[model samples]
Target: MYNDLSNEELFGPSDYSETSDSESNNEVSPCSFNEPINNISYTTFPSISGLILYENLLSHKQQNELINGIVEANYFDNPESNQAMCFGTLPSFLLNAIEIISRVPGLFPDEIQNREPLFDQACSIINLYKPGEGIASHVDLPRFEDGIVVISLLSSCVMQFKPLSVIEQGDDNNDNASYYNKFKDIQNTDEPIPIILRPGSVLALSGSSRYNWTHGIEENEIDEAGDEKIIRNIRVSVTLRKMKQDQLLLNKDDSNSFSLEVKKREH
Candidate 1:
């Protein structure tokens, strides 16, 4: 199921370069990276509310370091079509990355900071997608809190988002079909919006985007972004989320059962 696309075919020839660091850089705090760059472009899709994209949020060096850390981390073959690594507790090496992401201006709700107890249980997942591999469309379970941050590394690809109402119509149960039938006319007209996630970039989905829409990447070696055909690479995504404590308790007997349920759904 793997595509044998050469590095040259995917990214052309690599141009390696190195630069000296300036003394001014040493004075800048690591958290400063979270501040928005004036030149960086961002967009929020009209179709998918609360979906935000920040281009080139991380530096090339930071991206390389994070990728290396993930590679060295324990990862297992995910039944959902890619390799997966889950972290219940943030590791020391990834603390810097987490700090940078946490400090991202205007990304999280103000109440998020006050919910430190729940945030302390914050977990992360690293999904490694090789060429021709991608996730199917689905919304995250409600066991996760409202805010979801995903940092893209190593490559660029298009992620598509569609409304939940449309997806429910496809369910096998008659109750779901009946509930969705009223919107069948409108559902047929709804189209998935494609968002191109670049390497070292960040995408945050909250509010309506987190609860009402389904997002996934299409399985392909190359993705169409406007006129450019962006070739896929070993795309790694770091997803950070806080656990919904109430939902966690209500959903299963305990944390272990909840974990098992998650694994079962993936398979």
Candidate 2:
């Protein structure tokens, strides 16, 4: 992974708050999401689902091997942003997905107009999910001042945005204060919309749905084969964005560990 650099800082840790306090409101919406032009399903989180099928980006021979690697990465890597990122052999589909996302304008007029390409920078992320493999609710804090663009491939999951982490960091596991606040906030919807993204579906999580909203896919529940059998989902996702301007890319071979200070990024 990451060019076999043994000393590469795998990922920034969870406590790393690497953005400055200068915040600007970025208005975004899923408006263009429903248009027939893209033929893309425009569904809100935990609310809707659809299918977008792209042709073979990879040959039959290549798909078999790469798919297995994608599955393995999701199982072995940490979901937290401040941990080792899952970097395995990327499928052709994942790369193409990011290429498409990189060019698409932002969801809202303001989002893309202010920041073309809508983000300072971005990257590709592929994930795997076995039965009971779920990501708990968490705001993509700090770095997400600019939203994340996620394109889903292979399987589908209920991705929803509401609220979480409303109390002191401690004891939040049992408390519903944060949960309820988020629930109340989005109660106006006739129903909760969980975007069920199947393979080939591209979703841009920018708009009013940016960092202001928190979304995650519930653990997959499909255990087709026995425990001995390694059946699982191979989902490729690319999180493209405008990184905080002036923030230094974490040098892979940079031996700058043990210094976990959050750097202030000037706009």
Candidate 3:
């Protein structure tokens, strides 16, 4: 759906764009960063019900540019977690990447389009993970729309997902207590499945996989990949999400108010 020639006009020319004949040829190479990840090459993790993985979704050059762009931008510390993060609207430089990601066929549930505009107002977060740093196992809050995409850069790490039912049940009156207790019997029998997230790779969590499971990375300096122990480097994750309906309504109201103020001033 994206016209490469029109990209320059719409979002301005990005340094990561393919500009030469040689670079264009490299786009078809599996190892090249210019190559786009499509459904034919996409794979789903059988172990985790709805976890989809796209290898090399961003080329090496693109990955480097994304990392550099986020680094050059402002990032705030996350007060709720150990990992420092910043949340804001996506920058223009990153729009090209978002357009590319939006074109990935069958990336979301069919109902996603009916519920809201996908990527209309792109919201994103840049998370910085240091050596031995990782997030706890938790489900994404319901405030975000269904599909959650995370692009990994700089290092490869193992992400583990476990069914939320496996957690110990708390107060019975708690809203989610019943949901958690329903699978309590399966807790001992169920094992957390690990997925290796390499640099330039994209991980899409949706449907049951997004709500029913808790995902996290172990706080280890190194991750074991097959027989190799991959040392952890400073990694950055750029997560893209859509705001829920209520949030969208608030934004619409705020926009209308600003427009009214501007019109009054002009009159």
lDDT of each candidate versus the true structure: 0.60, 0.37, 0.57
**Alpha-carbon error at 126 in model 1, in Å?**
0.7
lDDT of 1 by residue, 22-124 (tens): 0111121222344653343455566667776765566655665676675565343444435443434455546667776665666656676345642323356
Candidate number that wins on TM-score, 1 or 3: 1
- In each prediction, how many residue pairs overlap at the backbone (N, C-alpha, C within less than 3 A)? 0, 19, 1
Model 2 residue 27 CA deviation (Å) reads 26
TM-scores of the candidates are: 0.69, 0.47, 0.68
The TM-score obtained by model 2 is 0.47
Off by over 4 Å in 1: 1-41, 74-81, 117-122, 166-189, 247-267
Candidates, ranked, lDDT? 1, 3, 2
Candidate 2 residue-wise lDDT, 110-143, digit = tens? 5454564454323333344443565554444343
lDDT accuracy of residue 160 in candidate 2? 50
What is the Cα-based lDDT of residue 4 in candidate 3?
31
